[model samples]
Target: MGILLLKLVVGLGNPGKEYERTRHNIGFMVVEELARRQGVVFRKMFWFPARQAKCRIGEHEVRLVLPTTYMNRSGKAVWGAMKKWRAEAADTVVIYDDVDLEFGGIRVRAKGSGGSHNGMKSVLEWLQTKAFPRVRVGIGPKPDGADMIGFVLGGFAEEELLKLEKVVERAADAVETIFSVGTERTMNEFNQLQIG
Candidate 1:
């Protein structure tokens, strides 16, 4: 069989310490975990603010990315990285936090609407395609009377944080599985999992 081309894994999140450990940045957390496993450091790239590491997983070369742009403007980084790598949508996987699913859960999709995620919205807009795969980490629903932005940007509670670690690891595993077995197979295995 021919060698499979390199794949881009983009984790969407805002830049800065303020967003660190927040529900909105679970994407970045997943990518960071993957980076740790590969021993690749994320360095800033011009045009796209991302940490890039070259590593191989199950026979496929992978480029892991964590966008520096804030959640709403994530497309700028994603589009630039995709173009720089000459990667197609099918070869790109975006990891992001999802408010619609319960906390600690994960959902993988081949392609779909962004739902209500501004980060995914920006990526889809910039890429001009929704055909790419994505791993959605559940951050749970917004609390009653809570501002949606505040809710997403807030750090996870102690219990939530512990559960989040497992979710992040699972998300990374899913990414590796996608590269090894293709999205359909990975989705079948991961989408049915409940993280909490």
Candidate 2:
């Protein structure tokens, strides 16, 4: 069997400048890194409430999308992008923040339940599948006394912010690796790295 070439990559996050630097927008951050490395600019499309960029990694044509429908409605953007590009669940990848893992960690899964992420849940609902690829960037667990909403919406601490800079870059590299290699190989290589 051949690897499903990635046709679309969606970065799940809330839009607007207010949510720009929050932990919940790490997915957005990773896509920005990808855009920078690929020299592509994302334009807000009127058809979908999202920003999109078109580019190629080697011979694979790819679309990078950032959903603007807040967190819960992220699936609408993914659905729109998938439809516009004629991409299937197996040909798309979603990158987002994960609070369950330690900060600076990266994990790639071919398919799984959403776990505790409402964004992923929204995606599963709209796409109607548990078989797409996903790249999870850990935002660390919430601190004691912090509510889930507040913690995810909050900005990273200064020290963690420094570390996150590298993690974001690595996440971008991981996405590229998925296109160059394949999801399973990328997962095995990245999931074993010890990042803070």
Candidate 3:
């Protein structure tokens, strides 16, 4: 199979201390893990309200971005990063949380709908395409009769945090696999993973 290159990875999350470590911010967690492993720092770009860092993996230069925009407004930052870095949709990967699966479960797709995710909707709307790759880290299903927003915004319980730590690690590994191989191989390898 031909190698599919990647130049940028965007992690979707809200900006603010309160949102830190929340289920919805798993994207941020994964990217932060990648940055730490790469020994790079996330610098705030003055032009756009996002934290970004550049590092090399294999023969490709890759960028890691965490949009400072609140989750609902994430598209603007993503679109801005693409323009600033001159990145094509094909060379970018978006990572975010999905509530439809069990916690720590991961699903990677080459391209697909945003479903009801506001952050993804914003990204797809701003990018003007759904043809980009994405890594959906499962945050588990919302409890019956629970408010969706509250469920997503809530932090993991003490025990769940232990499991989440492993999930975050695996999610970061999935991103690296995408860079080393291709999204198709990443999907096949990671989509079957059951972490936690």
What's the lDDT for all of these models?
A: 0.88, 0.90, 0.91
Clashes of each: 0, 1, 0
Model 2: residue 24 alpha-carbon error in angstroms: 0.2
Against the hidden reference, what TM-scores do the models get?
A: 0.95, 0.95, 0.95
lDDT by residue for model 2 over 36-119, one digit each (tens)? 989999999998889999888866889999998999999999999988878989889899999998889999988999899999
Error of 3 at 10 (Å): 0.5
Residue-wise lDDT of candidate 1 within 1-196, one digit each (tens)? 7685788998989889888888899999999999999988878887677768888777777889888778899898888888898988999999999999988787888999899999999998998999999999999878889999889999997888678778899999999899889889998898889876
Per-model root-mean-square deviation over C-alphas: 1.4, 2.5, 2.7
Worst 10-residue lDDT window for candidate 2 reads 1-10
* Residue 89 local lDDT, model 3: 95
Write the candidate numbers in order of decreasing lDDT. 3, 2, 1
Instruction: lDDT winner between 1 and 2, please give it.
Output: 2
True-vs-predicted CA distance for residue 59, candidate 1, Å: 1.8
Clashing pairs in 2: 103-196
**What lDDT score is found at residue 190 in candidate 3?**
93
